[model samples]
Target: MLTGQTLTTPQVVDVANEHEVGAFIGHHTLAEFHGVEPALLDDGPQLRDMLTGALAQSGATVCDIILKQFEPQGVTVLALLSESHASIHTYPERGSLFMDVFTCGTVAKPWLAVDLLAQAMGAADVRTNTVLRGDTHPCCQ
Candidate 1:
């Protein structure tokens, strides 16, 4: 019972003299950043700037950035990109944060964006996971 806009779509192709459609392919990077300074995690505007800058540097076109500051202490930064999207959710009390950067097509580097964000935040430990989404091989002709 969930509905939302999809970032990519299947493409039409010809395979074996017939018709075989291909799935969408994209790069998604998920990371957990630990040991960051607490103060750094609570600043909404600062986090927004950092994420957008990182995405731009990684060759992603940033469409818009949304930031939310929590009651006690925390911030969430979401960057809407032409390719896809990127986000950061913080836990200031624990000095940790979760990040995600997903991009469609080969032009943007999601991994590089994660690296830049981690470096800018000066995280002591960063655990990351990269996923190749959709069909690995597309037979578009």
Candidate 2:
């Protein structure tokens, strides 16, 4: 099983519900979209373009793009953005893609990448794992 980690401390939270203080009142949603088409998976330019567009469309600018490819065109692309990062690993043989999009202070945008992937893969369907990014509850008033 693949698990994830999220940091949360009391200093990070600030009464989420009411304006009762509103410290940790912000939310950041992280999502993983996987299971993409296999045939269209290629590394380098394709991956770079996708990663770049995904971040840019989400109101984040990419400062760096790292893409690696394996035999049979299995590509892993990591995009480092000003706000956060978005990554995609495509398995061409299985026609699957493992994607992670995360942001710190803003809500993550999923449809941009999803649309691009669907076009790139001609995917029949896509799946998503949306994590609410659990953090510490602010007890301080």
Candidate 3:
């Protein structure tokens, strides 16, 4: 043992060891955007198009999506994404919506998707909740 150094055992230390540190990516950002909307979500085709556009902006491709109108002022939408999935429930009379986006990959941009939904529904003064996902390598130790 010296002043600036220490003695070591005969074992070898591999400095070249490398590993994958994937971003805290899955479900990285989940936001709840709600506000007063001037439109209703009852048109299946229209809803599909809006969601499709949102996902498209974030470099994602949609395989399939489904939208259902519960009533005059209520609706439920289930959206499928190549990375994962997202959904929204609208209450027209209340002019509010409950939205969720869960996905994994570099293409996961929840903000873009939420913004598109807000624009499509004509929502103003929107609110949001962001949940960043995390993934760790158990073997990192």
Candidate 4:
């Protein structure tokens, strides 16, 4: 089980074996940001840069990106990476941000992206949940 802590590839493989999965394939990390800097959430351009920088910092290959700014004040950015995808949604009024970083293959680490995002957003508090995606355990189905 992933405890929202960074895991080595060998550790993940061991988890896969324990769970009866053929192999550890990929994982996803969901991070909730509370009390983030309001400007970071409200500014589309800045948020875009932050997200793009986070992806690059995590060693993800950016394939395509879409950034949308809301009418009142908010932004949503999605980056489709070669490994998988990373997305961010912000609510400036509530001073909250939600981010998801999913990466397939062993080359990229999703947790690294999450860490970078938390720092870039200046999150006062963060809650993260990570799950092993593509676990083929029969009991899990």
Best by TM-score: 1
Model 3 TM: 0.68
Estimate, for each residue in 1-141, the C-alpha lDDT of model 2 and write its tens digit. 122222121122323343333223233333333445445566457667866875676566678888887775678888886556777777676756667766544333444444455455455545444443334433432
lDDT of the candidates, in the order given: 0.79, 0.55, 0.58, 0.75
lDDT of 3 by residue, 1-141 (tens): 111112112221222222223434454334444455436554556666777788787656677888787755576777788677877776666666677776665445665677666666666556655554543334443
Give the Cα error of residue 96 in candidate 2, in Å: 1.1
TM-scores of the candidates are 0.80, 0.63, 0.68, 0.79
Error of 2 at 72 (Å): 3.9
Across residues 15-81, which tens digit of lDDT does each residue of candidate 1 receive? 2422123325677888888889999999998899889889999999999998999999999998899
Ranking by lDDT: 1, 4, 3, 2
Instruction: Please give the TM-score that candidate 4 achieves against the real structure.
Output: 0.79
Q: What is the Å distance of residue 47 in model 2 from its true position?
A: 2.1
- As for TM-score, the candidate ahead, 1 or 3, is 1
Best by lDDT: 1
What's the lDDT for residue 7 in model 3? 15
- Best of the two (2, 3) by lDDT: 3
